[model samples]
Target: MQRDKLITAEVADLLRPWFSDVTVGAQPVIGDAPAVLEQPDHAVTLTWRVGSDDPHDIVIMGPRTQARYHLERPGRDCLQLRFRPGRAADFLGRPLRDLADRAVDAADLGSKSLTAVVQTIADGGALAASQSHAARLRSLAEAIPVAPPTHTDRAALHRRIVAEATALLSIGDGPTHEPVHRVARRLSVSERHLRTVFADRVGLTPSRFVRIDRVRAVLARIQQKLPEVSSRAGYYDQSHMTAEFRNVMGTTPDAFARRRWPTIEACTAGNG
Candidate 1:
């Protein structure tokens, strides 16, 4: 199917920085390919196939620490909502640590807002395709709550630390990125304290977050050569980049660059 890339101004204003992308009509393209080894994602995702045939297919996927191997069936029209790093806690209204590397039924999260949005999709069914992409996104945007709940002093402190830490970790000087201890020091908190808060909010440790962020950076620039991509992505060398890719992506950089992965058009400017 031909894809449309457009974001209505109203939806864009509402979902910025918190929700990063809304992928409509996404289906994997696999031909004699082994199980796709997906890298760790910092954003928690809500995914459900379109149409009433699978109304109950809604899933809430938490941030992953390790790589996962899964065979995605072709020809399934999937819609996904990807929340920015550490921002899903506000919308989902729960700690993410328990959800690390897990995929659960949307009902399990007890998020009324997400459930309502899913209902809208279910009601729209195949007719949703006839509407403009911007119109559909506006509908979903309207159903979602923009404001986060109130937090106590300590909870607020943790949220602040996690937010700053995620931004710093997402952009670092080397392969190790910002050391956990150093980041803690900058935030005026103990290393252990930062780790605990980060895990609670992001569902992954600071180091793991850095690793995944680096891989994601590399993934975004698959058109470049290994040497250039490695250096730009803060890897020690091409070999180091390949090894890290193997560990987190379950495939070498060269091989992955050649594969026919699904197209993901970002709907917002926020990289988180």
Candidate 2:
């Protein structure tokens, strides 16, 4: 697969202060590759990948639960906008699961007009501008109509959930140390409630999120040339790491360290 590049827009600079070092650009995704799921630290993303041969590539919203499939061609590019959990939920107006596992065509998803959304948000007129990209997204959102439950007060709920999740992520190896209960306590909610919220907004539970986070953290450490990647990532031992690797990634850590490491590493290094 070709390395993905960030498609920078004029308005991207506005997001810079928040994302700081993260890269919020676009890259092309080619043919289908293996499925790799990720649990991101900050935002959920709206993603589009176009291939050279096929005009109708996939367009997806990569919530926490969804596995982002790898691209076969290096030339395939993607456009990604990362958002905080609450903002993401508000923007999408629905639980992430509603969009999962379904193959959506680029045309149906309005691929040609995406730049308008970028332009709108960049101009600081996301909610105000009638002709702006943000407005266009709202319009599209209206047409698609995937907004979250009306009674849930999605924005407030998302804020609370994200805060708790972030706090849990701050503690290294959260998943390994009774992750489910720890996260539930941090949120001042029961484990069942936490799972429900996460599933509703992110399409996954807290436990699964922790598992994915752990795998990504270990892989990141290894890429940085850190010694004992497993230990540093809070794995009790190599065996423990291997078990996690199998559970989350469906592969051995060594295989990931050798083959698929760069894609995620690049994503981590470049995510804005």
Candidate 3:
């Protein structure tokens, strides 16, 4: 995989504390790497993607009201800071779920505040002060009531869910045709337990997440110019690949290649 580049001062500042040792750089999507939809997590991200004729290519992804899928397309680059769930709500003064599943223009956030926040982090601001700000934000965010799972009391439950999902996502090139019993046996968990865990945490069944992961891998392969991308991504054939592509991306793979690839390329380049 190509290394992710972080260029903007704001993005650098926000992420430097956590990913200080990692290098950030630009990525170019030259071929079929359509931006895949990601499952929601409890994190806040501030991202900017450069555009062609447009200023940014952004979309919101997720079922929640505040979660969004933002993409910088046509190979435009982007810089983003992924924040913990509560932290985003605290900093933004609203539930992130309010923005879910819809794309909003970044210009909506008012450039001044965004710039200031970005610059503060980039300047190597004191961690103690940042923590204080984060606490203040959380206190304010507590007033809003969002319905997604807020707490997981069972450490074992959380581990089981994450581990099962990881294993499912690591399956071979195609969607799993094997029954849940087979997978459960491999993981040493009952099928029922696996299903419940995934539904509770990810809002999707284990099978669905596997399909999404496979589709994403397929998209990545297409971008890399691999011969027979379908086979490479674990699809049984081109037809299987097409079906999975439409299921997740809402368009045929070819259309995505023609229409969306350029935008993705732009986002990767501009963000880096």
For model 2, where is the 10-residue window of minimal lDDT? 22-31
Comparing 1 and 2 on lDDT, the stronger one: 1
TM-score for predicted model 1 compared with the true structure: 0.79
- Candidate 1 lDDT, 162-216, residue by residue in tens: 8788877774444445667788899999888888888888888888887888887
Q: For all the candidates, what are their Cα RMSDs to the real structure?
A: 6.5, 9.3, 10.5
Judged by TM-score relative to the true structure, which candidate is superior, 1 or 2? 1
Candidate 3: tens digits of C-alpha lDDT, residues 163-268? 5545555545454544556777777778788776555444446666556656666656655443377766767788888877776665667766664432222222
Candidate of highest lDDT: 1
User: Which residue runs does candidate 1 get wrong by more than 4 Å?
Assistant: 1-4, 25-39, 53-55, 66-72, 122-129, 172-177, 258-272
Q: TM-scores of the models, in the given order? A: 0.79, 0.58, 0.47
Name the runs in model 2 displaced over 4 angstroms.
1-13, 16-43, 49-58, 64-71, 100-154, 170-178, 223-227, 260-272
- Clash totals for all candidate models: 0, 26, 47
